[model samples]
Target: MNDALEIDDLTLWLGMLEKVVDGSTNMVVVTDRERRIKWVNATYSRVTGWSLPECIGKRPRELLHGPQTSAEELSRLASLIRQGQSVSNFELVNHKKSGEPYHVALNIEPIRDAHGEVCAYLSIQSDITERRQQERHTVELKQRLEVAQRLARLGRIDTEVETGRPRWSSEVFRILGMVPDEAPREFEGLLAFTVPEDVSDLRRSLADGVEAGEELDVEFRVIGRHGQQRWVRCRGVPACEDGRYTLPRSWSVQDITFYKMRLEEKRQRNEELNQLVLARTRKLEESNRALEEFSCALSHDLRSPLRHVAGFAHLIKENLAKGSVDDCLGFCDRIVQAAGRMQNLIEGLLSFSRMGREGLNVERVDLDAMLREVVVGLHDDAGLRNIQWRIAPDLPAIQGDAVLLREVWINLLDNALKYTGHRDISEVEIGWHPHPDGPVFFVRDNGIGFDPEHAQKLFGMFQRLHSEPQFKGDGIGLALVRRIVESHGGRIWATSKLNQGATFYFLLPNIADSAMPSDWGAVESVHAIGCRCGDSQAVEPGLQS
Candidate 1:
């Protein structure tokens, strides 16, 4: 029974020893006193591509050492082994059976006999090729990041809140114009470099961010250690663990002086442009006012002389009709016609000039009612030409100056009647329709229409489409219509086909309100006084007496 128990214990001890050697991931080799390989574990054979049978009779130098192995490391390892001591943590290059070089971390220990003499050596090795390559890659990445941060003028900072301590990267020190050794170690020390006016605000913002467990973003000015001032934008976020903020906050700061300078330049340029526009607008308004006054005075003064010439010529014709004076009568007739044509031209010019200068009193006016009144007045006039007129039903009301809009309708209808002269059953149509944005009023006529190519010129002062003999006109009617419509924030245009017909369209805004009454009575009184002198056949009685 005692023998069996001893055998069982021995088996267990052997199994544990086997496991200790075989289970190790590191390559292991055992050698005798002459440095001849005695045993090699599985890992050693796997790593070096040499079986135990191939390596058992060879020395350690023969199995692993080559020209690549450093002579200094070998000498140090030999010295330690000779003194019956163990050597550890030595790095060296070794060769495989395939002639490939490999780096390893080697630990060799000398085995001692009972007499205190070294009898064998045990070696443990770990392949470090991949680990060394990873280290190189990490170094390269750090170098690239540093270069990028320098070009971007950016800096990084890390601060521990519990200790109020701070650490800056190399770029941060460079940005602050301080050496790494000279950098501030405490938060207060870093805050001292900030501009006096911005320091308190930055502190408040940082405190709020930390309290709320939020990210921080702020812009402030700082004075570098060299006394140089710069604008910087800072952004940072906290890292937390286990419901408490454990990691120091990390932040990036960037210089923004160039961007701020560009914004200021743009603002200055805009201010200059606005000033130039204001000056030009003022000058243009002054010139327009002066031109309006000159046109009014010219029209007012020319009326008196024109009336005198027409009256005197008529008297001469009446007196000469009693005698055989054919030549004198013909001369008087030419004089009367020329004076009448000049007076018409002057009136047309005055109306065109006054259209743009007049103030607008905009209100809702029923276009249907206004057109009805205009058509009735035209039909009642003496010596009116025969024409067919049609007005559409349910014309919508528009907001506009009533007096100015009335003139627009009158001028359009009169032109239609005059241009269709002597035609059998001359037709005129006045109507309104709903447009996309507002109401459009139109006057259509079956007249001697002009070409569409010349439509743009139709609304110019004195822009007669036909000769004086073909169609007599001062050519100011459409021009006055265009000005009046535009002054009420509207638009005017015309469409026509030669010899077929012409249609004039104008748009006005629709508003729901009552029409504002104008001082039409005063205007009529003024017109009556002017017309009385215009129709008189004799000179003023006071001048004659």
Candidate 2:
């Protein structure tokens, strides 16, 4: 009877132990020494979807392991079990009956016999799939934030108002050329890296902004630890908590060196363009002044010829009424001469007008060859006259419109030949002097030149110092030469004294040195020394090319 009573108590204790293990949330399993499942609780069947009858005599790994399970972990668990060792919280992946993967924290203990030899093993597994997923999401967010900061060259600085302590992101340390350990604790310490010239103003601006609890925006320069200068733009706004200010501010800084450099370059280009426009406006005004002078001269010249024709025609009519043939013939001759002069004036004006409209066909011109060709063409004009041509042997080739430059040489040489008609021998020298902008070429003649005081009028249309009867010309040749020279971004001027020779100088900008002279259009005074072309005494050394 005592044995039966003891057996009943043992049975009750065993049933209570089973209820306690089965009621727990964790899945519980018991395996024999060979790692085959010998028993499983109701919770195991509920969680793993396998009844004890199916799991009996089967390994837990065979029932629960799937592709998500770590092979190395499974091997480690097997080795530990074979050594009769206990392992706690061995996290690993397990699959449900539905083939969905889940994570579990597993605890395993060896059940030893009275001799301390392992005979069975007990394992308890807790589902931890949701916690692991949350950890993975946190790590992904951190990685994305780091990538964004690097790409934008962005950094942050935050200050706690009460402590006045600063916190800097890793990127901020990199931007300041400082190591993570060297991060500044005080907000004022950041000013140590600022450039000296900007530090004072930057500090004041930032302090004022913080004091007012307002947004801050400023650009300044900083000197890095490596001594490199960099431009940075910093922006921030005050932070508030519980509707009251807590964090004074946080700043977002970005490197803007390249952007500032581009703005500076654009500003310089705009200034240069403005200067160019001003120069062009000045040139236009000068051209307008010249045209005004031409207009006044044109009116006087045309009206004089018309008046002469009218007066002489009226005389011829009166003489014809009297039947006086001799007097009428004289009047008719005068009218014809006046009409011819008017026609020449109109043609010259038309030719000058066309010069401004023509576009330049620029090319390399061999000036020496061109000068020789010009002399050959003018040979007939110098017939029976003693003329000496001294051209410089080293006249350099230049870039210009060949046809227009040829005209320049023609007009200059023709004037030289015409003015020196009274001289027994005409001496003309063609040479160039070196100039910074280009070569200054001159045509010096031993002909009768105008007074030095009237030199400015030499290039004005129809403004002649000498009478038309003495040196026959329309007085438009020099003016035409000036137009062509200026069109090529060059300058021209003349110098002379009464009864002495004249020198006409022009400068054509070299292609290699195409920049025009700053003092362009300024007249230069060149003194003259004379010698006859055919005289035994050689031409004046100074006058020779």
Candidate 3:
């Protein structure tokens, strides 16, 4: 009877243990030495969708692992188990009987007998799929936050009131050029990165703020390890401690180098603008002065020619009453000449004004062809026949407006023809010499040249050196030529001596045709006085290509 009572108690205890295992939500599985599932709780069946009857003789890997399981992980697990070791919280890829994959935190313990010999293995598995997914989501959020902070050139600074210690983010290390693991973690540590002069103010600011519970806000400069300077702003966040100075507080740090640089640029630009305004003001003042001079020239020069025409007309009418037919015709010719002189000055004014408004089209101009065209146009002039032309071969091309350049050639060449009109054997040379900035093309003539002393006043409009009778011009042609050369981004100047023929040299910008570097410099304005073709001594037209 005692044995039966004992047996009934044993049955009751075993039944209670089974109920405890089955009631829990955790999955429990027992495997024999070969890792074959010997027993499994109801929870395991629910989680894995496999009944104990089906998995009883199967290994956990055979029931849960498939192709998606990492082979290396499986091999590691197998090696550990074969060594009679316990695998605690070993992460593994598992599949349910429904063929859906899930991650599980599996803890497997080796059951030992009294001799400590491994006999069986018990495993506890928790559904950690949600936990792992949460971890991945957290990582993504952290990455995005870091990216945002970096783009703003922002970092954080934390200080502990109790320890009087400081902490810097990785970005601060970049600003100060310090290694994070070895970075100073105290107030003194900041002195290494900050300028020595600023350390005291920074320390005072922090001390006062901490003591008074006021948020710290300041800008400071950091001298990196490489001695590069960077500017940063620090704005403190409240510690929010309850009268506890031991709490930690933080300040936001951002690199304001770019902002400072922009401010500096703005100041410089303002300075430049102020100077430009002053220059323009001076130029306007000069223009007013020039306008007054123009008025004087107009009144005197125009009135002189008009008076001559009038006087000649009055004299011709008086002489006609007392003279023969030939004498009357001669007086009539004088009147006509005066009218023609006035007409030339008027035409010069028109040409000068027109060139000011002419549009410029820059291109590679075949100067040889342009000069040839000038020659063709002037060929019809009766005086060009006496002047012999010596044009250099293989003339280099230049960059300038086609129409403007052609006009330049016409004026220069026509001037050459007129100045040499008195020569029985006149020679004109057109050639080029290479210069650092560009090529200088010249038109030289053996003709009556003026005094070099008066060369300075040559290019002004209506400034004539010789009388109209000596050379038939209104002193407008050289001025026009200078204007054209200046328009083409070029320089023009004449070299002459009394009686020696003049050589007018000019340069045009190079847009094409050679490997020479085009160094653009400012072109100075030049002028020619009166262009009269007469004689002195002839210089060898030793022209260079």
Per-residue lDDT tens digits of candidate 2, residues 155-197? Answer: 7777656766677766666777878763445434555778999
Model 3, runs deviating above 4 Å: 1-158, 169-230, 233-254, 264-293, 316-332, 515-545
TM-score of each: 0.46, 0.69, 0.54
Cα-based lDDT at residue 69, candidate 1: 87
The residue-by-residue lDDT of candidate 3 on 1-545, one tens digit each, is 22323433433533554576876787888776688877788988998899989998898888898877889999998888888887888888889999888888878888765456666677888878788889989999878766877788887776655765677767777777766763436434554688879889987876777777666677788898889999988776446656655323566778899999998999999999999999878757645644554575588767887887788777777777777466667767877877787788778777766765566887777777778778767867754366577775556676678887887888888888778788887778776655555677778888887787887567777777677677877777887788788767777777777567778777775646473323222111111111233312112133222
After TM-score superposition, what is the CA distance of residue 168 in candidate 3 from its true location, in Å? 3.5
Q: Is candidate 2 or candidate 3 better by lDDT?
A: 2
lDDT (Cα, 0-100) at 390 in candidate 2? 76
lDDT of each: 0.72, 0.77, 0.72
lDDT winner among the candidates? 2
Candidate 3 lDDT score relative to the true structure: 0.72
